[model samples]
Target: MSVFQSINPYSQALIQEYPLMDTGKINAALETAANGYHIWRRMRFAERAGVLLNAAKILRAGKEKYAQLITIEMGKVLPESLGEVEKCAWVCEYYAEHGETFLADEQIIAGYQKSFVTYEPIGAVLAIMPWNFPFWQVFRYAAPTLMAGNVTLLKHAPNVSGCSLAIAEIFKAAGAPEGVFQSIIIDVDAVEKILSTPIVQAVTLTGSERAGTSVAAIAGRHVKKSLLELGGSDALIVLPDADLQKAATVALQSRLLNAGQSCIGSKRFIVVKAVLDDFMQLLLNGISQYRQGDPMETGITTGPLARPDLAANLSAQLTGSIKSGAKLEYGGRFDGCNVMPSLLMNVQPGMAAFDQETFGPLAAVVAANDEQHAIELANLSPYGLGGSVWTKDIDKGISLARQITTGAVFINSLVKSDPRLPFGGVKKSGYGRELGRHGILEFVNAKTIAAEL
Candidate 1:
């Protein structure tokens, strides 16, 4: 059997080790998930909602413990880790409160005695989650999936295996029946076998483009439904008439959040020529305040990357972009897993920093001739994830926001995911939606029932 270890990125100390589940154990989990699906699909909406609500309570009561584990395992600052846990609880409660209504039958206007479309669970769904926001990502998918009456199996990132098991326990303690939610500590090689199983109905993955493509291909070959949220080089467009201070502040906060590991975080700052210099100054001022140190320390505003390799990769991207004509305006030094918050100016379309998804605390600034050019620059990427348009004129911001092709676009605000809204991406960023009514319906069978008696 193979073993994997989780180490603190900040301290470089081993936290825990997990052994991979063998083929037999993986097969058993599949069988149990299949059985759980049968039981879960027949459960009432209220019953499932009860389980989710209980899970929310558990999450809140154990927030500190879970938050500490998140910080230790993934190197997110303690406060952010706590916020992630709270957000998980909020998602659980959100789905519990609204899932049934979201999945309720819709009346059809067909000329029959009775006609309607019913949403029903497809069966067991396999959620292949990432480690960046381990708890939030899983709950955002699982809460709605389970509340919609589908059992699920999880294949979380190896580095966050402890989080995977903890999530399984959350459901179990919340009164979920056997196998309703199982997290298997298996290697990537085992995913195909599980997906190939007849009992597995669909798959959802939140990871890199490569991983999403592979999983989508496997799901396609197996004829199972798939939803993917892949990598993004999200743009934050600052119009000439925008509030420079606010725009620069929000942009820095978004790019630096989670050490810049978020897919929705503003990776590129597209500023109009009129305010480019001013915005750059404000942005640099904000960057000067970011302090990287022990994630558990309250005074530290930034933490280490989840791994040292990520820091190295970010450094390489910076170097490539600079060679391609991007000027390093500020920090670009790396120490182990810690990357000093860096800024690159004169970033153009073809540069690595502009074109590729830089997954650390590095910010790229691109100058645009005008508003039209700003929108064009925003849409230049193959990634159509989340984006934002900043302008003092709310109406102008709204109009420009419509021009940017992405899953979600925010006007005069940072791009974020909300339970009340649908979230996903387009093009190479992956497809299908999650959250709100659209999310719960993703893995469901929308059966049209028409009858004349």
Candidate 2:
């Protein structure tokens, strides 16, 4: 009886209302997905790839439309929204082209005359995704899972319900069979019930640590495999020998992109004390370039926070950190969800901005005594989804990178997720991996077969 409403963050206007699926509809969807999985799993790898490739084609053809939907629905700037669509298409194409090779049987030398490991689909997989990068997150999981021969059931965030349905429509238009990919318009309770079903075999989530823990617990209870890509307080380490200009440029972009809603966005800037003042000046200048306005406008560099609550939460973190000794360097002005690009200096381990994930246009700068201290400060966070170490010396950078505790570390570069690399995190950031060969294999049954010649 309850209806879900989608609101445009920028205009604060109601976009659409979706009625919840009742028990009967939910049962029917599960049954359909189960049936589709049976057919999908039996198809040749080439055949499966063909459908995914077609989906990619559809995404490309409708890029503009989907980009507009993303901007209007979630307040992503127009350019970034378009880039998100392009990235989603890229993932689809990447998986369509390489998934079969990644999932191929591996030969093993053992006592048995013939032995091999085969990857087999594990029926329907439930994907619970977030809204920040709505399309990209879902496609990143779906492209590989579907290509690996498993059908997908997406439980996307409620705020991006329209984008969710649009993605489902794209798959259908690309000739995906009825339940190969279905977007369920349901609540959290419905998600738990669906996961409890026998047909849904596994789960993958990209959201908060709290959400990941809850879903992981449910999956554990049912003995279903789960992959979680949760919250991140990624540290951007800048050493004395690093290029401060380049580091500042990339750091600001990484922190401010998507209005700083990204999980892997650099939340803490760990700078060596020798170059702290210089890097601080560059960081301030870099932050000055961002201009927040209507996301649909072309020249606008940033947009409003996805929701008012998110803005308020980030504000609390900012005020709390300032009161705790972190000095406000620049830009802390906010009206509703439209927050100014802000920077906090002299941030220490105990400050709220340093301790918690500030998911908005706020950057925290923590001074480190030296290279070793920078690594120490970077590893100090409870959440370690991703981190980057900036240093001109490759060997030193690589050495320090190994010592940092995180999912993926980049040397002299920003942290990002690519279809070619396995991405995830340790600590409270969640477990398991997504993307690359590891992702396709995550939801599959790696059965070992041995036989006598």
Candidate 3:
């Protein structure tokens, strides 16, 4: 058995090492989750909701410790990691408060016939999450899935093994049954075997493009449900009449949040010619002011990439962008695992950074001739996860936003994952949502019941 070491991205200190699970433990967890689902799905809506609500309280009471583990494992700033924990709690409570109503039986009129749709659990759901927001990503899926009467089996990033077990413990403390949600310490190679099991009915992944494809293929082979939130080259569109100052500020935050490791983070900035200069200036100024050092420090706005390889890949992407005619405006160098926030200009369509998802502290600026060009450039990529269309004019911004071929678009705002609204993307960004009513319903079997008149 191989024991993988977890390190703090910021301090470059080894946190701990865990022996990878063998076949026996993986099979046991799968069996447990499958068996637990039978009784879990039979529970009353209110009863299930109570488990999730209690989990919310458990999270809130221990937010500081959970946040520390998250920061130590992945280099998320303490404040931001705390915010992630707080958000996790919110997701838990949200489902607990509204799940019953959301999943209630729905009546429908089919001409002369009457029909109703009843939501039912789909047994054990396998959640494969990333390290960027370790706790948040796992809970975002777990809260709703558990509340929906389905059991969850987590396969988290090995680097964040402690956080993974911590999450499962919290749920257990909140009155979740023995197998309601289990954290499996298995490698990617082990996923297919678990997926092949009889009890695992669905899987949801928040991970890299490669991981998404691998999991999706396995899930497809088994004819199971899959929700994939894959890589994104999300565009931040700034129009002529846009508030340059606000746009630049939001753009900086959107690209830099989670140390620039988010799926929906803005990797490309599409600016209309009229405001290109102003937007570029503001972007440079904003990037310069970001505080970077130890993430454990109270004021640091940025942290190292989750690992050294990620930083190296970021360097390669920046180098490739420069080679492709994109001008490196600021912060193009990488030291160890810390890559400073970067801004690239003169980005053309064919450049790797312009079209591909740059999962680091790099942003490519593509100047557009007009609104049509901006929209066209934004849609040029094969990935269409989410984007923001910035303009002061509400009607015009909303109209242009509607035209963007992304899962979600914001007008005069930044792209975000909200539990209240539907989220996911089109094209190669992968299918299925991770938030809102759509997310809760994603893992359920939507059955239609009919009664003869």
Candidate 4:
């Protein structure tokens, strides 16, 4: 297999093959990024902010083209891909507008002296991002670090190098120093050298739990910061009092968004016994209407699951679940990389799909006798990324949402990302927040200035 062949998920056609990056290039980029940080970190915040805002404009103007690359490279539906572009641009502009205030030093008084806290760029950061939400993943890490005055080097997935390079172009066009944001289009082997380098201050990754574990180990050995955003088998709970139709609709949207590729996606549906049948039937009808075909088609609600392996794994998982007593409903077959929206019922706690991340268009149905059982099922997973509870009673929903052991939980709503909120998880779902003020300080040094009297 070619290291860089572009395979169109729609037609399963080989589009093009680009050269894989070598270690030499990666080392050069690391050096350049480190040096760029020296300059970028010292530049006036207003000046850097101007560049970021300009980058945002460039992103807005080129949104279509960027979205096209995302769909072409990874097979995300065009509209959703375009939405990712817009969100990415918004994050950049958000940081440009608010980063200064967020990073501003605050003065405090010691007993007869003054002490202040100041945030500064740590240095260069290495971002190992995933193919899903390609632009959003990179920018979520990049925008905050850059706004905090750090330089960045991205080691993007090989399949989406084109998108990676496109992002670099945006920074360059925005008048950033040549190395301020560089994409090292290299293979997995090249990462170790970059991480071990003296220049790379920390590392961040948004991918699978295995990937996060690997990165965490490498960063640990190097004594560097590693912000991990890992996998999630989040719960979507529907209380007995919940509007079954609304619960089903939001569940369908939350689970199938991005073809169910997101880390914080709603994977497990925990419904109270009182409305299990209603929620199940509604879920079936709802997912059945999602047309599975070429992402470019306007009628299509779901598309191919990135690559053929994803389809194969999803199929095998669903099959095993069926053999283990779970029943498949809706669309469960895989034709190439497309595993049609699948629902599994009678899923007990021991099944892999019950706790493991299916990572595609497969949703597991777990029956809960009551709200307490719902919380128990949601907390049973090692992955604690995100979850949602549906209830007409807002107070009860909030109470139950607080019981789930996840980074984020929603009541009467599906979980999602927002620029104003901190997003991340505990447990195997990984550590560190991705957006908001807390995210900006992840790669920064919060130094204290104290006076001795």
Candidate 5:
């Protein structure tokens, strides 16, 4: 059978290799999950919560080991990798405490004497996740779905196969029964075969628009529910009256974090003409502070892109944007995956930087005539994922935020996913929500019952 190798993006070291599972192994896993779901679904909420709580403890105790693995495999800075592990633990704790209540039955006043809507588990859910923030993405989907009594089968990115197996082991050590949570090492054809199986009930994907579309089409063909969290070119709007220094600081942090691999990372900086120059200057000053090196080493503020291809793609986009009239302000050079954080000024609607999602440490600045023009520019992208509006006036911020068509919009702050809030996007950015009450309910069947008293 074929094998998948996990390599360190920074050092170019081979971390581990995984052999692909064949048809027999795949069938066995599906059968086990189908059997395990029956038992898991019947368990009490407190019992399920116990398993998740134990998983949280395991994650916390092994944070350093897991964090190091993330850094080695995905090229995230060591500190950020540690933070991702901590966040994964937090998600587990959040669901363990609130999942039952989030999925609790809702009483309704109907014609019958007693009527209510109950949320029940939908069998096995297939989570197809990306490599960027690998641990966080998996836990965010697993924590709630498992708590809601649904089994999970993860098809993680091939480059992070070691991480995928590590997570599965964590759940196993935390007292999860076999097959309740399994990371299957399989190919794309195998994924299609699994999705076609009757045992796999639903699907959730966090990847590029192309991958999302392909998975969604297969899920649709089988009549299985699908939740997609896809690509984004989110706008970071800076109003004239906003705090320039704070905006610049947050903007740089949001864009450069994970070396700008985040789907919700601010791709377009829409600034009002009045304070554009000040914001640009402060942004440049902030960019100068970042230092890129080995992700495992200390004192490195930024790490390389996850792979060489990602860096090359970002380079092409930067070159095309510059050719399309956008000016390269600073730092456009890259050594393999180790890209220097770059900035592009005079970015307009037609330029690659402004029009496409740049999944690297490249920032694009677009000038807006006024507040209305800023909102218009923000909504111009085909993507409607997360966005941010920077303004001191809460009322104006809220009003302008409402005008921008996206999933989640933050005022005076950067956009991010929180366990307490629902997260997803609109239009080509994909559909359905994750996290909070909505997320817990995504894989559950909301059954309405009516009976006479």
Candidate 6:
């Protein structure tokens, strides 16, 4: 059988090895999931909530332990890893508290004497998640999925196999049924086999554009629902009236969080010419403060990319963008997975940094003549993920925010995912919302019933 090794990205040491499940094991898992779904679907909403609440307690109790796993396996800074674990617990608690209300039956006025719409579980859901924000991504999906009475099977990124198994243990410890949640440490080749099986009723993927396309196609062929959260080149627009210092700080934070491996991180900075110089100076100051070192250290603000190939790919993008008329403003060097928090100026539409998703600590700045031009520049990308608009005028910020062609927009703030709000993207960044009331509805059946009195 094949094996998936979990290696520490920083130390370059193997931490653990997980054996990939064979055909027979995979078949057995599917059968178990199918049976688990039946038991989960029949349970009361309160009972389901109890399991999730227990999960929240468990996550908080073991926050440090779980956080260490994330940092060691994925190279996220220690503080950020701790934050990610806390956020996972929050999502579980959020769904546990509000899931019943979100999926409550809706009364409808129809010609029939009685009419209503009921939300019901479909079956087992397969989630194909990425390594970046591994814990947050899985819990955001699994918490709601389980509360909605659907079992889940996680096919996490191979590099984070240990995280995947640990998640299974969380559910198990929280008193989940045998098949209610399972993590299958299988290769990409097995995705099709699992999706084709009758037990999996729907699918969700958080990955690149290529993976999203392939998974969506397979789900379509099987007549199952699919939700995708793909790559993004989100724009962060700074207007003339914006607070240059604050904008620069938030921009730097968003661009460098998780070493800029976030799909919704502000990859493009569209600054109005009136305040470009001031904003750039402040941004440079913040960049100077970042210290790259081991992720486990408390003082180090920057960590290595999750893999050497990722750093290499990011280096190539930086080189290609610089060659395509983009100027290297600051910091353009790589030592293995440790990037130098590079910044590029004079970036245009054709440059690789502006056109493609730079999944590293590389920031691209594009100049705009005015607010109108800034809005226009932001809309030029095929990605419509989350973005932010900075302006002193709240009304003006709201007005300009409406013009950006993205899924979610914030004014004078960094773009982020919240349990209370819906999150996802449009265009090539993929489709379907992932959180809030909309999220629990994604993999459920809205059955309509009408009857005479």
Off by over 4 Å in 6: none
lDDT measured at residue 381 in model 6 versus the true structure, 0 to 100: 88
CA lDDT, every model vs. true structure:
0.93, 0.92, 0.88, 0.88, 0.93, 0.93
Structure candidate 6, residue pairs in collision: none
- Give the clashing pairs for model 4: none
Worst 10 residues of 2 by lDDT: 1-10
Cα lDDT tens digits, model 6, 58-149, are 99999999999999999999999999999999999999999999999999998899899999999999999999998999999998899999
TM-score of candidate 1 relative to the true fold: 0.99
Mark the regions of model 4 whose C-alpha exceeds 4 Å error after superposition: none
Model 2, runs deviating above 4 Å: none
Q: Residue 285 of candidate 1: its Cα lDDT?
A: 94
Tens digits of per-residue lDDT for model 5, 1-453: 499889889877888889999899999999999999998999999999999999999999999999998989999999999999999999999999998889889999988999999999999999999999989999999999999999989999999998999999999999998889999998778877898888799999999999999999999999999999999999999998898899999999999999999999998999999999999999989999999888878899899999999999999999999888999999998998899999999999988898889999999999999999999999999899999999999999998888999999999888889999999999999999999999999999999999995
Summarize candidate 3's per-residue lDDT along 1-453 as a digit string, tens digits: 487779988778889998988888887887788778888988898898888889889889998999999988998788999899999989988888889888999999986477999998888888998899898899888888888999989988889999999998998898888889998888888888888887888999988888889899999999989999888999999988888899999999999998899999998999999988888999998999987678898789998889999998888888987997889899877888888888899999888888778888888899999999999999999999999988878999889888889899988888888878888888889899877888899999899998887
- lDDT (tens digit, per residue) of candidate 2 on 1-453: 488889999989999999989999999999999989888989998888888889888988999999999999999899999999999989989998999899888999999999999999999999999999999999999999999999989988898999999999999988888899999998888878988998899999999988989999999999999999989899999988898999999999999999999999999999999999999999888888889989998789989999999999999999999999999999999998899999999899988998889999899999998888888888888998999989899998888888998999998787899999999999999889899998888999999999996
> How well does model 4 score by local distance difference test?
0.88
lDDT of 3: 0.88
